[model samples]
Target: MKSAFIILLAALPFAAAAQTTQAELLRRGELTGTRPSARSQARQTAPRPANTASDPVQQHLLQTDVNLAQASADQLPSLYERFIATTRDERRQWTYPQWDAAGQVLARLNQRYEQVRTTLPLEERLRVRSFQGEFHTLRGARQVKDKLD
Candidate 1:
């Protein structure tokens, strides 16, 4: 019994860590590409604020960002039809539980934005109109999963 307890305790950290990593990957969509380093993973998983409509770029990006994360998934082709139909105004409704879920999604996308932000050059960044928009669109894909569940 003692040995079993010890084994279970030993396994706890690994289990917790795996769960954390999975959540981070799902939230940030960092697991899609070739394996990323721990350093990059840490950067990509860093927490970010929920969607804020302060900047035009942020506003437009948030408007269109729905479903961006779903694109990287294997089922993307099947999901595209439904994902494209959800509008920004619908998402922005901000009801109780729905707002909570949307907040989580936006936070995840914000982390993804941080990871990719430096990759763009200044000129290209200017053209981006809040590259965060694309990230939001990707994140928006999760909305369908939510609906099905």
Candidate 2:
């Protein structure tokens, strides 16, 4: 019975060591913790901004003039479509100078579209063609208004 008591006392330290947490062991530098998983490490690192542009059109539009001018002309139709949609929403609130600027941007975009029409993808070319037809109709209506004014 005295031998059993001595064995139990000797085993107490080992049992207490087993109950110690991984963090505690790591802090004590006695045990190396398992390396973090790739997914877990990524979560711990700096996160990307939620508002950053992800769409190609948004990326192109947000680029500086030099970068935008360097972009593939094949992307013009989509960029123009995005521009038109944005301007259309703000048209009612635009000053004359703002409208003029939009018109100048549209003209430049149209020129770029013409230059790359053949090189553009079939879908983009078709979209531009449709947009051109609608644009002309709108221009004709605007012209009549201008003549009357």
Q: What lDDT does each candidate get?
A: 0.43, 0.50
Clashing pairs in 2: none
Q: TM-scores for all candidates?
A: 0.28, 0.44
The CA lDDT at 136 in model 1 is 47
Q: Give lDDT tens digits, candidate 1, residues 69-120.
A: 3223222222222222343446545444654454444454434444454564
For candidate 2, what is the lDDT? 0.50
At residue 36, candidate 2 shows an lDDT of: 44
On the 0 to 100 scale, the lDDT of residue 134 in model 1 is 39
Candidate No. with top lDDT: 2
Model 1's alpha-carbon lDDT is 0.43
